[model samples]
Target: MRVTILGSGTNLHPRRAAAGYLVKTDNLFLMDFGPRTLSNLLKTSADRHQIQYLLFTHYHADHFSDFITFFFDAVCHSKFVSPRADLRIIGPKGTKALFGTILRTFPSFNDSEFRVTLKEVSTRSFSIGSTRVTPVPVTHTDRQTCLGYRITFQGRTLAYSGDATYAPNLIRLCRDVDLAILDCSFPKNRPGEAHMHAGECGRVAQEAGVKRLVLSHFYPIADRFDVKKHAAQVFRGKIIRARDCMTLSV
Candidate 1:
């Protein structure tokens, strides 16, 4: 499996983009759709039209904002040229309602030529093409549903922590995976609410026994500290700091 970091920074970070990732195996799979998601993906070998499935972790603006442009701009443009196959979107509970509201607000979105299917998922496992996806509920805002995804394709497992604090569900989702892409939003010294620091991420990586840990969702404050060094203090496994446009083979 191949994974690309489309955007790895938090909402507050100016230089780095927001949270988003693109995975390629049998098909293109996207996790989260933050501000720079489409733009960053365009820089790579892939584009928004190539994405087969889109999995959202939560409805936070930093994570799901780009969906507006993706649907309106890309899908609309593709419709005039050559509409691709169905674009399947899976997310936590209320996803269908959310998209319904979007369509209600802008009814013109329903006039698209391309097909879009939205599926609201919970703590369940399902398959999309060759990939098996499992959503593990995690702790975040009380107002909205949050989850981390464990994706298995071609015998390789990749776990992504959307926006979570220290939760047991996250640990279970990451267990013995090929790659654990965690939310290291803050540095160890500046721990924030509903987010994990480098040391905490190290603990999760260590406890989960993931083969490799890629720390993402970095806040600007974390720029002052050595994130990998801090995570290395607790985790003995390989650690990588995620950057926009960085691609890795898992």
Candidate 2:
């Protein structure tokens, strides 16, 4: 399995793009489509036409604002070509309503070239081609739907924690994963309420026994602190600071 961190920064940062990841197994899987996702996707060594599934963690602008742009770019506007296969969008509860609102707001957007199927899922296991996916509810902003995903394919496992606070559900979802990408949005010295600090992310990865932990989704303050050192104190595994266009093989 191959995983690419297309965008690793938060909405506040100017250098790194927002949350977006590309996973390749039997089929192409994209996790989280944040604001700069479209441009970041073009930078990776991935074929955009091969993307078949999009797993959304929530509807936050920093996490899902590129959905419209992605769809627009996928369609061939000037030339006539065969339509592409349908793309499946799997998200937390209220996903359908969220897209419905977008469609209504953008009346000029057309879906004739390709079809999009949106499905809301939670705490359940499902399949996309040859890969298995499990969505685990996580602690986040109040009244907002957030989730962490566990993916297994060809005997390899990977987990992604998207915009989550420290919680048991996240630990369970990432237990024993070959690679665990977590949200370390704040410095350990200055903790945030809705997102995990470096220390908290380290503790969770340690408790989950992940082989490798990738700290990501950093705000600007994270650049001023030693995020890797903070996480390394608690997690005795390979710690990687996520960067845009970084790739990992499992």
* Each prediction's whole-model lDDT (CA): 0.88, 0.88
Output the TM-score of candidate 2: 0.95
Please give the lDDT score for candidate 2: 0.88
Query: Largest lDDT belongs to which candidate?
Result: 1
TM-score of each: 0.96, 0.95
The 10 consecutive residues of candidate 2 with the worst lDDT sum are 74-83
Please count the clashing residue pairs in each candidate, in the order shown.
Answer: 0, 0
Which residue pairs overlap in candidate 2's backbone?
A: none
- The best candidate by TM-score is 1
Off by over 4 Å in 2: 77-82
Candidate 1 residue pairs in clash (backbone atoms < 3 Å): none
Q: lDDT (0-100) at residue 208 of candidate 1? A: 94
Candidate 2's error at 172, in angstroms? 0.4
